[model samples]
Target chain A: MIILIHGLMLIIIGIWAMLTRKNLIRIIIGFAIVDTGINLVLVAIGYIKGKTAPIINDAVSTAQGAAAGMQAVDKVVDPVPSALVLTAIVIGLAVTALMLAYAIRMHKTGRSLNIDDFEEQKW
Target chain B: MIETILTIVLAIISLMAAVYAVLTKKTLNAIIASGIISLLASIMFLLVSAPDVAMTEAAIGSGLTTVVFLYALKHIKDRRSTHDD
Candidate 1:
């Protein structure tokens, strides 16, 4: 419950940052915040009370894990979210790098990082 | 009780950093603050029982991303300085 609220708060703050900031770097920062927030929310959703890590270790079960089988599943937390988050984290890094590269190019072409200066098409 | 306290403290740290990163006037400060936010988030991931995710967040989200941003910033500054000279 508390985890959900915290995750949601982070998401809202990140969105606000993205919506209000004009600097390209700041916008990228906001995008990272939002990315982290979503990852947090996903992990929070996967939490189950009193369960251990989703590993087949001896600490989780007494019957050597593989032999424990059904008993192991009941004691461990869900592995799905952790697996998914691994991929998400790497993708987030790639996206952030791409965005920063774009910002560098924008600065090169426009001589500014304010983002508002990039508007070549006028109303 | 202790877990709850830890979670609350971490959440406050992360959200504060996020807000500061957004609202700060200096671009560099904003970038650093955002990095701090990611650092705290990795800690939170550990508390939530996702050590693998925490490791990824710490390395890629907090560490690699900040370095990349710094490199870009340095590149821009150098180009601008050369142009001025």
Candidate 2:
């Protein structure tokens, strides 16, 4: 239920951002929003029911009496999404930086940031 | 149960901010609106038990990104007319 709402909202925002926003910067921001929404959805998907952290430690082993400790620790939320989100974050940063750099360069060359202003490449 | 409600509320806020970001005529306003959307989304991430994602969203989504956008905005003059040929 929670995942559905978050996922749906993410899709809607991504679509809206892609549709509107004339300025290149706004469009880029929209992309970022879409990126964030997707990340949230991914994290939500990995959440488990009443799970503990995936760490296996001496304290937990002693508390759970060693027999059920292994099973208990194994019930932790899936770490895949967490790993993926970390990668996604780095990628997002790289892309944002590249896009901003491009925006800067475009502004320098054409003296404008409006999407419609750059027609020089059309020909 | 409560988590679902919170998610719905955050989703609504994010969508509203997204709409405002898209609808605003001024570029700077649009950027700020987008920032709000990111900020809300970060909080939503926290509620969902994604502290790592929440931190990233809070830092990159709202912090560095906004600063970069504003810096870029500062370098360029505002072109009021979108239809200028």
Candidate 3:
């Protein structure tokens, strides 16, 4: 419950940042915050109290050989969420870079970082 | 019991940094605060038993991202200065 709230609160703050901020780079920072918040929430969901990591080890009782690794399942936290977050983090970096590039080009053309300066269309 | 308390404390600190980063007027200050937010978050990830993710976050999120932002900000500043002269 506490973990969930922590993650959700960060997300809310990120959204607020993106909404209230005027600078293009600040908006990008807000986007990164949202990405981090989602990653935290996903990892929080995968945690199991008092359990070890998903690695097969002696403490997890793999004594029956590699084929009996299933026994370790109950003793460790989930790996799926961790893996997913890894991919998601990389994607977020790429997206942030792309956004920054766009901001750079906009600044070059307009001599301003304010998002409102780029507004030409009335839609 | 102790771990829970530590986590709660860390969470509050990071959240505050995030809020400050968003609300700060100066772009440089906002960027630095956001970097601190990522640094603190990586520490929290370590506490949560995700060392791999923590390392990745510290490397890409805090390190590379901040460097890129600094570069871009410097470029913008230089361009504006040259334009004035």
Top-scoring candidate (TM-score): 1
lDDT of 1 by residue, B13-58 (tens): 8778888888889878877887888888888888778889989999
On residues A1-123, what C-alpha lDDT tens digit does candidate 2 reach at each position?
465466667667766877665667877877877777778778778877666444544533545556756665566667688779867966886798689789878877776677889987776
Error of 3 at A5 (Å): 1.2
lDDT of 3: 0.83
Model 1 C-alpha RMSD vs. true structure (Å) is: 1.6
lDDT by residue (B1-84, candidate 3, tens digit) is 998898888888888898888877898988888788788778877777777788898998899888888888888889989985
lDDT of each: 0.84, 0.73, 0.83
Instruction: Name the candidate that leads on lDDT.
Output: 1
- lDDT for residue B65 in candidate 1, whole number 0-100: 87
What is model 1's interface RMSD? 1.3
Report the TM-score of chain B alone for all candidates. 0.90, 0.83, 0.91
Under CAPRI classification, how is model 1 graded? medium
Tens-digit per-residue lDDT, B1-85, candidate 2 = 7867777777777777777877778878877887887788778767655677778878877887788788877655543233233
Rank ordering of all candidates by lDDT, starting from the highest: 1, 3, 2
- Per-residue lDDT for A39 in model 1? 93
TM-score of 3: 0.93
Q: After the best TM-score superposition of candidate 1, give how far the Cα of residue B53 lies from its true spot, in angstroms.
A: 0.6
